[model samples]
Target chain A: MIATLLVVLQVVVATAITPLLIGVMRQVRARLEGRIGSGVLQPYRDVRKLLAKEPLRAEGSSIILVAAPLVLLVSSLLVVALVPLVTTANIPAVPNDLFVVVSILLIGTVALALLGLDAGTAFGGMGSSRHMMIAALVEPTVLMSVYALSIPVGSSTLSKIVVARGADVTRVVTPAGLLAVVALVVVVLAETGRLPVDNPSTHLELTMIHESMILESAGRDLAWLEVGSWLRLTALLGLVVNLALPWGLADSMQPLALLVAVVTLGVKLLVAGGVIAAAEVFMAKVRLFKVPELLAGSFVLAFLAVTASYLAG
Target chain B: MNPFRLLKLIARTGRIAEPAPAAPVADTEHPIPKALRGSVQVRHVDTGSCNGCEIEIGAAFGGVYDVERYGARLVASPRHADVLAVTGVVTHNMVEPLLRTVEATPRPRLVVAIGDCAHDCGLFAGAYGVAGPVSDFVDVDLEVPGCPPRPEAIVEALRRVTGR
Candidate 1:
C-alpha cells in the first residue's frame, strides 16, 4: 500500500513540480542577466492557462500529431513511476532497470519526432530531423554513462545499484567515475535542449531545434507536451543525481526514511537549478553543424570511462 | 560564481525595486478569476506595418517592461495563443494569413489591435494593397491606440485584458 502511494506521489510531484523547476530556472537566468524576471510560480500560471485552453489542431494532421502528446505524456510519467525519486527502495512489485528506464525515455523522444514529421510544415520537419539526429547521438552516450556507473554494482537493476553504492563516498573520486559524471552532465544538457545544444528561449525559426516540433500545437495539446518535457527533464536529472549521490535514498520502505529522502532530493534539485542557470549564462549556443562534434566528445568520454573501469576490474 | 554575490543579488531584488506595481491588479473591479488570472499567451500578427509598432510590442515584453511577471508571454504559434495582438494596418497580401491565424487560435479568444495603424489603418489609411483596419478583418476585443504605444501602455492594456 505504501509503495503504491509512493508511486502515485512521485507521479503527482513530477506533474506539479516540473513546471516550477522550469520557472525557477528562467527566473535565475533573468537574474544572472541582470534583469527582473517573472515569479517562480510563473510556470504554474502558464500551465493553468494552457490547461484551460481549447486545443487547436492543424489541418491535414494525422493521428500521429493528435496522439503524440498523450503518448509522450504517458511515457514520461511511466519513467517517473519506475525510477526511484524519493527512495531507492523498489516499489512493491514495480521493477525497473537502467536500460529499461532509458528505453522508455527514448520512446518518448521518438513519439515527439513522429509528431513533428506528421505536422507537415517546414519548421516541424526541420525540428524533427534535427531532434532525431541529436537523440541518436545522445542515447549511446547516455547508455555508456549508465554502463560505467553500473560497473561497481555488478547488477543492472537501479534499486540494487543504489543499495550497493548509496554510501560509497569514494565512488566519484576515481578517473572513470569523474568521466562518467561529465558525460552524464553533457547528456542532461543536450537532452533538456539547453544552451550549447539548443536554446529553449529563442522563437526564431532558423535557430530552433526542439521548439519547432511543437510549434504547430496549441492549447491543451501544447500544455501536455510541455508537461511531458518537464517530467522527462526531472526524470533524467533525478537519475544523474541519484547515481552520483545516492546516499540519502531510503534503503527500506520506511516512511521516516522516505521523508528524509524527499528532503535530500529537494536540495539536489535546487542545486541542479543553480547549476543549469550558470551553465546557460556562461555557455553560448554552438553552431548547429558543430553539435555532432560535441556529442561525439561526450561519447568519447563515456568510452574512456568504461574502458578505465574495465581495466581496473 | 561567488555564492555570496548570488545571494546578495537575490536579496537586493527582494526590495520590490522593479515591477512598478501600478497596474492595480489588486483593485481591479472585475477580477480575472483564479484560473484565468494566470497567463496570457500572445500571438503577434503584422498585417502590414512599417515595423514601428513591432518594436514597441517587443519593448512591452522585454526586461525593462517584463510582461512575464504579469503572466503574459509572446508565443510563436497562433494555436498556442490566447490573444491575437495585431499590429499596423491589414494589407491585401496579409488578409488570408491574418484570417487563417485568427481561425487557428482556440476558442475563448481575444484580439487586441495595437497602435493606431491596426485600429484605423493609421498612416497607411488609403494606401493601395491596404485591407483596412483589423476590425474589418476580425473582431478586436480591445484597442491600444497610439502612433505607437509605450511599453507600459501595452502592459497596462494586457493587464486590463487579463483583469489583473
Candidate 2:
C-alpha cells in the first residue's frame, strides 16, 4: 500500500514539475543572452494553447502519427513511477531493475523515431535516421554506466543502488562512482536533446535532430511530443541527481520524509537544469559526424568505470 | 572567445531588451482567442519581399525588441505555429507556397500581414511577376501598415495576437 502511494506521488510530482523545469532552463538561457525572457510559466501556457488547437495530420499519414506521442508519454510516466525518485520503496510486481528502466527508456526512443518516419517528409526521415543512430550509441552508455554503479550494491535494481550509495558516502566519492556519474551526465544531455549534442532551440531544420522529426506535428500532437520529451528529461535528470546526491529520498513511508523528498527533488532538478542551460550558452552543438566521437568517448568512460568498480569491489 | 571572457561579456552586457510597452488595446473584430491569449508560436513566410520587412521582423525578435518576452516565439514550421507572420507581396512563384503554408497550419490559427507590401503590394503593386497581396492568397487576421513596419509595430501586432 505504501509502495503504491509512493508511485502515485512520484508520478504526480514528476508531471507537475517537468514543464517548470523546461521553463526555468529557457529563462536561464534568455537571461544569459541579455534578453527579457518569456516568464517561467511560459511552457505551461504554451501547452495549454497547444491542447486547445486542432492537430493537423498530413494526408496518408498512418495511425503511428496519432499513437507515437501517447506511447512516448506513457513510457516516460512508467519510468518515472518505477525509478526511485521521492522514495526508494519499490511498488509490488514492478521491476525497478536498471535493465527494465533502460528498456522502458528505449520504448520512448523508438516511438519518437517511428513518429519521425511516419510523416514521410524528407526532413522527418533524415531526423528519424539520425535519432536512431544516436539512440543506438546512447543506450549502451546508459546501461554500462548504471551497471558500474550497481556493482557494489550487489543488485541490478536502481533503488537498491541508490540506497546503498546513500548509506555509504565513501562509495559515491570513489573513482568508479565519479567516472560513471560524469559519463552518465554526458549521455543524459545527449539523450535529452540538450546543447553540445542537439540544440533544443534550433530553428534550422537541417541542423535539427529532434525538432526536425516533429516538424510535421502540430496542435495537441505537438503538445504531447513536447511534454513527453520534457518528461523524459525530468525522469532521467532526476535519476542522475538522485544517484549523485542520494540524500532526501524517503526510505520509509513517513509523511514528513516524503515531503522533504519532494522538495529536494524539485530543487535538484531545477538547479541542475539551470546549470545545464547556463553551460550551454558557452557551447555549440557539435557536428553530426563528431557526435559519434563524443558518444564513443563517454562509452570509454563508462567502460573504465565498470573496470574500476570491479577492482575496487 | 575564452569562456571567462564570455562570462565577463555576459555580465557586462546584461539585459539589453527594452522595457516592454503597454499591451495593445484588444481588437474587437478579431480578438485573440482564449487559447492563444498567453502564447503564440509564429512562423514567418517571406513570399517575395524586397527584404525590408524581413529586417524589421528580425529586429522584433532580436534582443532589443525581444518579442519572446510576450510569449510569441518564431518557430521553424507552419505546423508548429499558432500564427502565420506573412511578409512581402505574393509573387507568381510564391503564391502556391504561401497558400500551402497557411493551409499547413492547424486550425485556430491567425495570419498577420506584416508590411504594406503584404497588405497591398507597396512598391511591387504593379510588377509583372506579382500575384497580389497576402490577403489575396489567404485570410489575414491583422496588418502592420508601414512601407517596412517598424520593429515596434511588428512586436505590437504580435502582442495583440498573443494578448500578453
Candidate 3:
C-alpha cells in the first residue's frame, strides 16, 4: 500500500514541478545575461493561456500530428513514476529496470521525431532526421553508464542500484563512478536539448533541432509538446541527481521520511537546474556536424567506465 | 576568450538593463484578452521595410530594452504566436505571404502594426511596389506611429498586449 502511494506521490509531484523547473532555468539564463527575466511562474501562465486557445492543424496532416504529443507526455509520466526519485522502495508490479526505463524514454523520443515528420515540411523533416541521429548516439551512452553503475549492485533495477549506493558511500566516489557520471552528464545535456548540444531558446529555424519539429503545431497542441519535453528533462535530470547523491531518499513508508525526501529532492533539482543554466551561459551550441564528435567522446568515457569497473572488481 | 576572462567580464559587466519604467496604464480602447494578459508570444512579419523598423524591433528585444521581461517573447513560427508584430508598408510582393502568415496563427490572435510605414505607408505611400498600409491588408489591432518607431514605443505596444 505504501509503495503504491509513493508512486502516486512521485508522479503528482514531478508533473507539478516540471514547469517550474523550466521557468527556473530560464530565469537563471536571463539573469546571467543581465536582464530581468519573466518571473519563474511564467511557464504556468503560458501553458494555461495555450490551453485556452484553439489548436490549428495543417491540412492533410495525419493523426500523428494530433496523437504524438500525448504519447510523449504519457511516456514521460511513466518514466517519472518508474524512476526512484523520492523513495528507493519499489512497487511490486512495476519494473524499474534500467533497460525498461531507457526503452520508455526512447518511446517519447521516437514520438517526437515522428511528429516532426508528419507535417511534411522541410524543416520538420530536417529536424526529425537530426533528432533521430542524436537519439541514436545518446541511447548507447545512457545504457552503458548505468550499466557501469549497475555492475557494483549486481542488479539492473534502478531503485535497487540507488538503495545499494545509499548503503555504501565508497561506491559513489570511485574512479569508475566519476567517469560514468561525467559521461551521463554530457548525454543528459544532449538528450534534454540544452546549450552546447542544442539551444532551447533559439528562434532561428535553421539552427533548431527540437523546435523545428513542432513548428506546425499551434495552441493546445503546442502546449502539450512543450510540457511533454519539459517533463522529459525533469525525469532525466531527476534520475541523474538521485544516482549522483543517493542521500535523503525515503527508505520506508514513514510520513517524516517522505517529507524529508520531498524537500531534499526539490532543493537538489533546483540547484542542479540553476547550475546547468549558469554553465550554459559560457557555452555555445556546437555545429551539427561536430555534435557526433562530442557524443562519441562521451561514449568513450562510458566505455572506459565499464572497463574500469569490470577490471577493479 | 578563456573561461577565466569570461567569468571576470560577466562579473564586471553586472546588470546592463536599465531600471524598468512603470507599467503602462491599461488601454481602454484595446483591452487585452484575459487569456493573453500574462504571456504573449510574438511572431514578427516584415512585409516590406527599409530595414529601419527591423533594427528598432531588434533593439526592443535586446538586453538593454529587454521587452521579454514583460512576458512577451519572439517566436520562430506564427503557429506558436499569440500576436503578429507586423512591420513595414504592405508591398505588392508581400501581401499574400502576410495574409498566409496571419491565417496560419491560431484564433484569439492580435496584429500589432509597427512604424508609420505599416500604419499609413509613411514615405512609401505611392512607391511603385507599395501595395498599401498593413491595415489595408489586414485588421491591425494596434499601431506604433513613427517613420521607424523607437524601441520604447515597440516595447510599450507589446506591453499593452501582455498587460505586464
Candidate 4:
C-alpha cells in the first residue's frame, strides 16, 4: 500500500514539478540575457497543446516505431517511483540502495534511445548512436562516484547516504565525498544532455544529440518526451541534493516533515538549476573530439574518488 | 521572446545555427505488403550513440518523411515492434539494457543495425566501457551505415526488412 501511494506521489511530483524546473532554467537564462522570458507555466501550456493534437505515424516503420513514446513515458515515470522525490522513508527497498535508483534511470535511457532508432530514420540512428557513445563513457563514472560516497557512509542505498549526512562529524568534511560530488555534477550534465557535453537546445543535425532522436514524434508523443526530459532533469538534481545534503528531509515519515522535504527539494532544485544555467551560459561547448578528454577527466576523478573511499574506509 | 527566435539570436551571435531538425519524419505509408498488410510493427533500441541518427530515425515519420505512407508504424514496447531498429555501439554499461531491449521486442523481429556505430563502433571504438560491437550481443540482419545515413537510406533499409 505504501509503495502504491509513493508511486502515485511520484507521478504527481513528476507532472507538477517538471515544468517548473524548465521554467526556472528559462527564467535564469532570460535574466542572464537581460530580456523578459515566458512564465514558468509555458511548458505546461506546450504539453497541453501537444496532447490535444493527433500523433502522426510513419510509413514502412514497424510496431516498435508507434509504441516508442508510450514506453519512453512509462519508463521515465517508473524512475520517479524509485527515487526519493520528497522523502526517503516511503521508498521501500531491500536496503534503499542508491545504485538501484541510478540503474533504473539508466535503463529508461536505453528504452528512449531504442525508440529513437525504431523509427528507422537517419537522424534517429545518428542520435541513438551518439547517445549510446555518451552513455558508454559516462555510466561507469556514475557508479564509481557513488562508490566513493558509499565508502564513507558504509552503505550504498540512497537513504543510507542521507543518514550518513545526518551523522555528526567533527569537521563535516571528507575528500571522497567532495570528489564524488564533482564527478556526479559532470555526470548529471552529460546524462541530461546539457552544455559542455550535449546541448539540449541545439537543432543542427550534426551537433544534435537528444533532440534529433525524437524528430519523428509529434503532438502527444513529443509532449511525453518533453515531459520525460523535465522529469529526468529534476530527478537528477534532486538525487544530488537529497543525498549530499539531507539536513531538512523527513526523517520520521511524518506528514509535516514530508512537506518540509518537498519544499526543501524545490528550493534546492531552483538553486541547482540556476547553477547549471549559469554554467551553460558561461562555458562554450567543447569540440566533439575533445569530449573524450572530458570523460577521461571524469574517469580519473571517479578513480580517485574510489581510492579515497577505500583509504578513508 | 520566442525561445526559438532567442535560440536563433544566440546561435547567430555565437556563429551557430540551431541544429536543423533532422530530415522531416517520413509519413508515407508503405505499399501494403501482400502477405501481411497490417501485421508489421517496429521497435527501436540505442546500444550507444551521440544522437545524430536518432532524429533522422524520427524524421522517417514526420510531415516530410511521412513514414505512414509506407504502412509501417512505431511501437512503444518491444513486445509490439515487429522489427528491432538497433543503434549505437554495444557498451559495457549498456549491455544489460541492450539485452533487455532485444528481449522486449516481440518474436520473429528483424534486427536492423542503424548507423556506423551499430554496424561497427563508429567514433567510440576502443573505449574501455564498450562491449565490442553490437553483433557481439545480438544477431543483426540489416545494416544502415552512415555517420547517420540520409532518411531515404533508412527507408531503403526498412523496405528490405518488410520486403514490400
> How good is the docking of model 4, as DockQ?
0.02
TM-score of each: 0.93, 0.99, 0.99, 0.64
By DockQ, the better pick of 1 and 3 is: 3
lDDT of 3 by residue, A1-313 (tens): 8888888898888889888988999999899898989989999999999998889999989999999999998898889989988887777887899999999999999999999999899999999999999999999999999999999889999999888888999998888888998999999999989989899999989999999999999988889999899988988899889889988988777889989998888998989999999999999889999999999999999999999999885
List lDDT for all candidates, in order: 0.81, 0.93, 0.91, 0.69
Compute the TM-score of each model's chain A versus the native chain A and list the values: 0.95, 0.99, 0.98, 0.92
User: Which residue pairs of candidate 1 clash?
Assistant: B25-B164
- Model 2 over residues B1-164: C-alpha lDDT tens digits? 79999999999998899998999999797667788888999999999988999999999999999999999999999999989999899999998899899899998989999899999989889999999998887888899999888999999999988888
Q: What lDDT score goes with residue A193 in model 3?
A: 93
- How big is the positional error of residue B30 in model 4, measured in Å on the Cα after superposition? 36
DockQ of each model vs. true complex: 0.48, 0.93, 0.87, 0.02
| Candidate number with greatest lDDT | 2
| lDDT of model 2, residue A102 | 92
The regions of model 3 sitting more than 4 angstroms off are: none
Which portions of model 4 miss their true places by more than 4 Å?
A1-7, A90-96, A169-172, B1-164
Give the per-residue lDDT of model 1 (tens digit) for B113-163.
Answer: 999999998888899889799999898877898988887778887887665
lDDT of 2 at A172: 88
Which CAPRI quality tier does the interface of model 2 achieve? high
- Evaluated on CA atoms against the true complex, candidate 3 attains a DockQ of 0.87
Rank by TM-score, highest first: 2, 3, 1, 4
